[model samples]
Target: MRLAPVRDDVAGFDAGEAAAFDPQPVRDAGGSGERITSLTSWWHTRWCQVCGHTFRRGDRVLVADSRVRHLDPTLDCAESGGGRADEAEVVRFTEGLLATWPVVGDVPLTRTDDVPGLLAPPLGGLRRAACLFCAHTFRPGEFVVMCPCTPAARVCARAVHRDPARGLPCWESWRPGSTLKVCPVTLTRLAT
Candidate 1:
């Protein structure tokens, strides 16, 4: 019979450290507040499984969990004053990110009316923008860029250009204030 690892009051030996001691795979949430179903040494590194983008330990990376509300479509385009061409340019910028990142899990290439309701408000808006290429989503006030080549235009700009090996895709920009949230992979912008 195996005994569980005893948890102590040590600083680094918090819940996360204790969970790692268990021989059986532990299901828990990460420090970033993301729900982690399993432990992976891969996460120990700054590399993002969803997009294969690397980061330093303290660097802030966006985690898109569709378990929350889907992004609003009304906010997809530029904020009225911004011209259509300007919106198009933003979209182009997002496409570049998708081309570069690894995109961890299966993402919908197109937008669907079947989008689920808000499990909870994302970091920025009434709903979070789901990634067109992977499981990632933007929190409220969180910004991302996507590629036009993707089925929709919901990619994030910040992480998109970080990795050069992935290269740039024809993309567009999606800001948090828009009424519609466009899917970078499918280019489908859904209304809130």
Candidate 2:
């Protein structure tokens, strides 16, 4: 989708120092094996692939070079008149797939960087919640991850600290063992 970082001071991708980032292990994860550069947004908005929400200004996002193509009646259905059927099949499959993923009730912070804006304080319409991993209330601008577990396995769709750099490695601590990588709450297998 060609999204740039949402910083007012930065003019474009070249203006900011780009770094390599591993793609989040999500469904249909897109990104070439090559090192990808993150761009700063001067002007433009994009929908978060993980949450499907609009990206606010000043939000730092990691974007991959990928495009989702929709089948067109003339280009695809013309060959077999299967556009409608194909579209319906795609929709049904998507719905079924999404049903299997984590069911966080609120709009989730897709990346650690988005926590500042999405989880801002009351003066900024704060979202009051606690981290499932450590049981501590989340402070504004803290890096966190909304528990990406199935509804039955989640403890109120909690948010947990994800940034290890600042000494809060709650997310990394949640799933301690390498045994199938299940959620700690109910041992339910995580989608990603």
Candidate 3:
């Protein structure tokens, strides 16, 4: 079996000293951390698979395995090697490392109001969206109702002005006396 060079370690070893070195490949977070060394022979020098340079006495070189050859050419030691053999398996390995990665930047707070229960604008502000009924922009602090017509799979219709006193009579004009209250965005029939 070809040992996977999962451990990202670099070590230097003399010609005969590598025979004594016994390194282990990284399996998971709890894996034994060992440095992988590229051997330099007294009789002849070995060429690097990545940079095409001859391995000198103490050059830091990354060693690849059968698994590494399947990785992207930019990352792998083999220049022509490309495409992931198992993207899901690669994700599984990195997911553990990603857990330890530091969290950067604060998440923006959701904006809330008394009228809409639990439903709030994303990132403390409403994205500028026009009302399909009146062709008017839904401004901030405006009382608007999202069309309940859309299914869970599809994107919901644009918000219409609910409070006619504060804004344009969009909701009133859209609903009453219409044979079909189809959502302008999704073109789906409104749930009456």
The per-model lDDT (C-alpha) reads: 0.33, 0.42, 0.39
lDDT of 1 by residue, 47-104 (tens): 3333333222222233344221111222231122211235556556656654665343
- The collision pairs in model 3 are none
Runs with alpha carbons beyond 4 Å of true place in candidate 3:
1-127, 148-157, 177-181, 189-192
lDDT order of candidates, top first: 2, 3, 1
- Model 1 TM-score (2 dp): 0.20
C-alpha TM-scores of all predictions: 0.20, 0.28, 0.28
Candidate 3 is scored at a TM of 0.28
Residue 61 lDDT (model 3) = 33
**Candidate 2 structure quality by residue, lDDT tens digits, 70-97:** 1223222112222234655654654454
Candidate 3 lDDT by residue in tens digits, 1-192: 433433222233352367557654433222222222223222114333333323333322334331111122433444455443465664454444334531122211111133343232223343334555664434334455454244232356445554443334455566543233676666867666
Give the C-alpha miss distance for residue 181 in model 2, angstroms.
8.6
On TM-score, the stronger of 1 and 3 is 3
Q: Which ten residues in a row have the lowest lDDT in candidate 1?
A: 161-170
